[model samples]
Target chain A: MADTESLLTTPLDSLHRSLGARMVPFAGYAMPVQYPAGILAEHLHTRAQAGLFDVSHMGQAEILGDGAAAALERVTPADVQGLKPGRQRYGLLTTEAGGIFDDFMVANLGDRLFLVANASRKAEDFALIAAALPAGVTLQPLPDRALLALQGPGAAAALGGLAPALTALSFMGVAAAEIAGVPVLASRSGYTGEDGWEISCPAEQAETLAKTLLAQPGVAPAGLGARDSLRLEAGLCLYGSDIDETTSPVEAALIWTLGKRRRMAWDFPGAERVREELANGPQRLRVGLKPEGRQPARGHTPIHAPGGAQIGEITSGGFGPSLGGPMAMGYVAREHAADGTALELLVRGKPLPARVAPMPFIPHRYAR
Target chain B: MSELRFTKDHEWVRADGDAATIGITDHAQNALGDVVFVELPEVGREVTAGEAIAVVESVKAASDVYAPIAGTITEVNSALTEDPGLINREPTGEGWFFKIEPKDPAEIAALLDDAAYAAFVESLA
Candidate 1:
C-alpha cells in the first residue's frame, strides 16, 4: 500500500494558506476545499465571472513510444489513434470486467500522448495503464507539473488579453504557449461546463502564475466548494463520488464518451461488459434529477417510484448556483429514465419530490 | 442564564426538565466554517442519546450533530431552512437549533461545562 501522504503537492500551498483557505485532504494532497468567501459566494462568483481554481493536484502524464496511442487504447475505450494533434478527447478507463476505473481526458501532441487523470485515482490509473501496455512503451508520470482551471464566461476574454493564441483555440483544443511570458500548456477545457482554459505549468512556478492570473479583472479565487457545485450545474461527475470502479460507463450515463472505433473490437478491459450494456442497455441508468423546490436531494438519498417503491439512489447532488434551483445526478431503474418521469428522494427517511430531467441544468458556455 | 449542558459531539443544551434548547458551540461552527445547508431534526421525532439528530453541510463536506441525551424533539429552528448561515453568525443565539424533552435530566450533568468545552476546542487547534 502506498502512503497517500507521499502523493503530491502544489507550489501554491503557502498562497492557499495565506488566503485563509479551508484546506482539506483531497486525492492524497492537502488542497483548498473552500476559501473565506465560502462555497456559495465562490460558486456564484464563478457563474457571474471567472474563478481561479488550483487543480494542480490532478495527475498529468505523457505516454512515450511508437505504440503510445495503441498502448493507451488497450486500457481505455477511446479511439486515441484518430485524435489529431492538439485535440483532446474525454474517455473512460475500465477494468477487465467492464467496470470503469476512471474517466479522464487524453490529448495527442503529435509526439507523445498527453494524459490527465483524476488526482485521487491517478496512481491506480497509472498502474492500470502500465499493466496493459505493450513492451517497449514508457509511461512518464509528470507529477512535477501543476494544473489550474480558470473558468466562467469571463475566462476566455481574460485569457484573450494574456494568451492571444487561445483566442483561436476552439473547445477541446490545446496549445503549448505562455501566459504573461510564463510557459504553459493551455487547453480550452474545463469541468465547470463554462468557457475556460486548463493551464498546465511547472510546479515551482505555479504560485507566481496563479498570482498573476488572479490580478486580472473579473478573476476571483474559487475553492473546492464552488468547484463541486459548478461541476454539478454542468452535470459533470466527481471521480470518487459519482463514478467509481464499481460503476460502469453505461450505468453512469457516460456512454457517449466511449468512441465508436474503440467499441467495435472491444479491445479495452471490460469491453465485453461495456458492449453488452451498449447493445441491450444497463439494468439501471444514471440520470439528471431536478427537485421541485429549493431543498436539495443529496447522495445516498433513495430514489422511489410512483408508489414509493425503492428504485435507485442519488450519487451526486447540490444547489446549482447558476440554475437557481436544486439539481442532482443519480442512477435509477431504466424504466424511470424519461425526462418527465416523477420520482422522489428519501431524505432523512422522508421522500422529497423529484423529476427526471436533461443534464447541463444551466447550459454549457463552451467557445465552440 | 439557564444551566448549560454539553455533548461529546459539541452540542450545548439548556434543559428545564422536559424542554431542552440545543445549539452548537461557537467553536464548532467556526471549525466547520460557512455552513451552506442544515438538515434539521423534525419536531415530534424521538431521538436517542448519541444518535445523529441533524446534518450540517459546509461547501466541501457534511457533518452530523447528534442528540446529547435521549429525548423527543419538540421544536426545530425553521429559520435555518432559508438561512443556514445563521449558525455561522450566532450559533448560541438566533442560530439555536432545537428543543427536546429529555427522558432523563441526570444525563445533562454528565456533559462538559463551558470551560471544559473551551479546552477541548483548543486542543484540536
Candidate 2:
C-alpha cells in the first residue's frame, strides 16, 4: 500500500538499454530480462566469472532507536539483540497467523541495523515495521541509495582491487568503505550462492560505482534473467514466487533460519503456530525436483504421485542452464519430501517422469 | 514451382505442385532473437488452416507456428535437433520446420505475396 506499484528506476537503466537488453516489467521496474549474449551465456558467466547486477530496486534501509532491535524483534523472530557489529543474518517477517510475509537480510552496522528486502514487498514490510516499532525507534528508509550485486568466484578479486578493505570481510559480513573514491556500504553476501558482495551507495554515486565495477577484467553486466536462473541454481528461495502467505518457513525447509533463542522464547509474530509446527513437522515441505527431459515444468505445473494424484505444485521451475538439464522446486507432502522419491510433473497435460533430488542440483560454491 | 506465399501468422510457403516447404519469414526469425528449441510436427499429421502445427521456442519465449493452409505433413526438418539456432540464423533456408502437401492450393493464392509480406513487415516496424 506504500506506493509499491510506482515503477522505480535504477541508475543503470540507460546502460542496460545501450547494451541491447530486452526490458520487461519485473517487481515494478523496467528491468532487463536478457541481453544479446542470451541467458545461457549469462548464467554460465556468473558461475565462472563475476556478473554485475543492478539490484537498486530492492529495499535498503536503516533502523534507528535506542530499542530498534527490540522493536524489530516483535515482527521478526530472529534474535537481533544478539547480533554483533559487522555480522549479518537471514531473517523473515511474518503475519500473526504464522505465514511468511517476506524473507530479508539484516546486518548490524556500528550504530544501526541495516536491512535489505525484496522490491515488491518493501512497502508492506516497512508498514509492518513502522506499526510494530515503539515510539523510540524510527524507521529510516534510504531513499537516496541503490544496491548492486557482484557475484561469482572472481567478485572478491574485482572488488578488492577497488577497495582493499572489501577482501577482509568474511561471508555474511558488512563494511563501510569507498570504491574508486565513491562511498559505499558493502556486504559480502549475495543471492547467487557464490562468494560475492552486495554494494549499497547513494543513487548519485551508483553510476560511477557500476562503471568502475563493470570495467574490471572479469565483470560483465548481467540481467534479471540470469539472476533468476543463477539463484535457482544456488537453491535460494524467491519470496512471492517460491514462498508466500500460504507457505510457512518450516514447510519451506527454512526452520533452520529461526534462531534457537527466538524459538524457545516464542516472542516473535506467529510464534505459537511456528513452534507447534517445529515440534511436529509441518504437513508439507519444499523439495527439489528434476525432470527427465529438456522441456521444463515452469511455474504452476501440477506435481503428481504415481497414480496421477495431485500432491503439490511447482513454485519455481526452469531449465538449469548451468546444470544442462531441467530443474524445479516445489512443495510436496512432508512424507514425500525425501530425495530419490519418484514423482511426475504434469506438463501440458502429459505427466513427465521426475525424481525428488537434493537441491542446488548444482552444488553451491560459496567461499564459506 | 507455382509461387511463394505467406500467411498472416508469418509462415512462408513455396508451393510446388500440391506440396509446399513451410518456414518462418526472415522478419519473424529476427524478432524471435535466439532459437533454442523447436517442436516439429510429425510426418503424416493432418492440420487445418490456421491451426497450430508446431512450436518454436527461442531463449526468451515459445511461439506456435500455425498451418498456412489445410495440409498433411510430408517431411520435417530434422536439422533443428542438432542446431535449433539455425532458425534465427536462416529463417528461410535450413530453418524450415516441415513440408506439407496442401489439401487446397487455392488457399495459398489467398495468402500474402512477397510484396504484401514486405509491406506487412514494414508496417510492424
TM-score per model (chain B): 0.92, 0.94
Scanning candidate 1 chain A in windows of ten residues, the lowest lDDT window is A1-10
Tens-digit lDDT string for candidate 2 (A1-368) = 23424666687888888888877778888787788777778878889999988999899889998988888898988888888999888999987888899999999996998999999999889988989988888889887898999999999889877898888988888999999889999989999888899999998888889999999989988888889888887888999889998888788888877888998888888887888898999988999999986666778999999766899999988777778777889999887889999999987677889999998788877666
Model 1, residue A83: what's the lDDT? 92
Tell me the tens digit of each residue's lDDT in model 1 across B9-120: 8899987657989988887887776676788888999999898989887654578898998889999999987888899999988898899898887888889987888787
lDDT per residue for candidate 2 within B1-125, as digits (tens), equals: 45679987899998876578999988888667556677788899999999997888654456889999898999999998678878877888888888889898888889999999989888865
- Which residue pairs collide, candidate 1? A98-A270
lDDT to native, each model: 0.86, 0.86
Off by over 4 Å in 2: A1-6, B1-5, B16-18, B25-35, B58-60, B113-125
Residue A195 of model 1, lDDT score: 88
Off by over 4 Å in 1: A1-8, A134-137, B1-6, B14-20, B39-51, B59-62, B67-74, B100-113
